[model samples]
Target: MAQREVIVGSRVGLHARPAALFVKTVSAQPVKMTIRKGDGAPVDARSILRVLALGAKHGDTVVLEADGEGAEEALDAVATVVAEDHDDPA
Candidate 1:
C-alpha cells in the first residue's frame, strides 16, 4: 500500500462539499483507495459518507492509502484532490 499525509486546506475542512468532491476525484481512479484520519480505520475514498465521517477539518492531517496497480499514482492524485480543495458541491 502507498500512503500520503495531507492537511485539509478548505476552510470547512473535508465537509459536505469538500467530501463530495473528494469522493468524485478518487472514484475516477482505477486502483482501490482508502483514507484515514489520525489513527482511525481507513475508509473507502470513493464513498462520500465514509469520507465525510472522517471529520477531517481544516488543518487536520489525513492519510490516503492504495494497493494495486498504479497505487502510487492513484494515491498521489487523491492527495492532489485533498491538497487542492477541489470540491464543487452543488
Candidate 2:
C-alpha cells in the first residue's frame, strides 16, 4: 500500500462539489483508495458520502491510501486533487 498526507485547500472542504469531484477522480483509478482524518478509520475514497463524512475542512490534513495495481499513481492523483482548492473559480 502507498499513502500520503495532504492538506485540503478547498474553502468548503470535502463536501458537496469538492467531495463529488474527488470521488469522480478516484473512481477512475484501478486501485482501491481510502482516506482518513487524523487517527480515524479510513473510508472508501471513491464514495462521495464516505469522503464527505470525514468532515475535512480547509487546511485540515488527511491521509490518502491506496493499494493494488497503479496504487502509487492513483495515490498521487487523488492527493493532488485533495490538496487543490476545488472551491476556487476555474
Candidate 3:
C-alpha cells in the first residue's frame, strides 16, 4: 500500500463541495483508495458520504492509502486535491 498524509486546506474543511471534489478525484484514480482522519478508521475515499462523515476540519491531517498498481501515483493525485483550498476562487 502507498500512503500520503495531507492537511486539509479548505476554509470549510471537507464539507459538501470539498468532499465532493475529493471523492471525484478518488473516483478517477485506477486504484481503490481509503482515507483516515488522524488515527481514525479508514473509509472509502470514493464515497462522498463517508468522506463528509469523517468531519475532517480545516488544518486536520488526513492519511490517504491505496494498494495495487499505481498506488503511489493515485495517492499523490488524490492528496493534492485534498490539500488544496477549494473554498478559494479557482
Per-residue C-alpha lDDT of model 1 across residues 15-90, encoded as one tens digit per residue: 8777887888898999889899989999888888888888898889999999889899888877877886544355
Write down the RMSD of all candidates, one decimal each: 2.7, 1.2, 1.2
Estimate the TM-score for candidate 3: 0.95
Clashing pairs in 2: none
Best candidate, TM-score? 3
Best by lDDT: 3
The Cα local distance difference test for each model comes to 0.85, 0.89, 0.92
lDDT for position 57 in model 1: 87
lDDT of 2 by residue, 1-87 (tens): 789999998899988888998999999999888899989999988778788889999999999988788999988888888888867
* Better model by TM-score: candidate 1 vs candidate 2: 2
Residue 61 of model 3, lDDT score: 99
Flag regions of model 1 displaced more than 4 Å. Answer: 86-90
Error of 1 at 3 (Å): 0.8
Ranking of predictions according to TM-score: 3, 2, 1
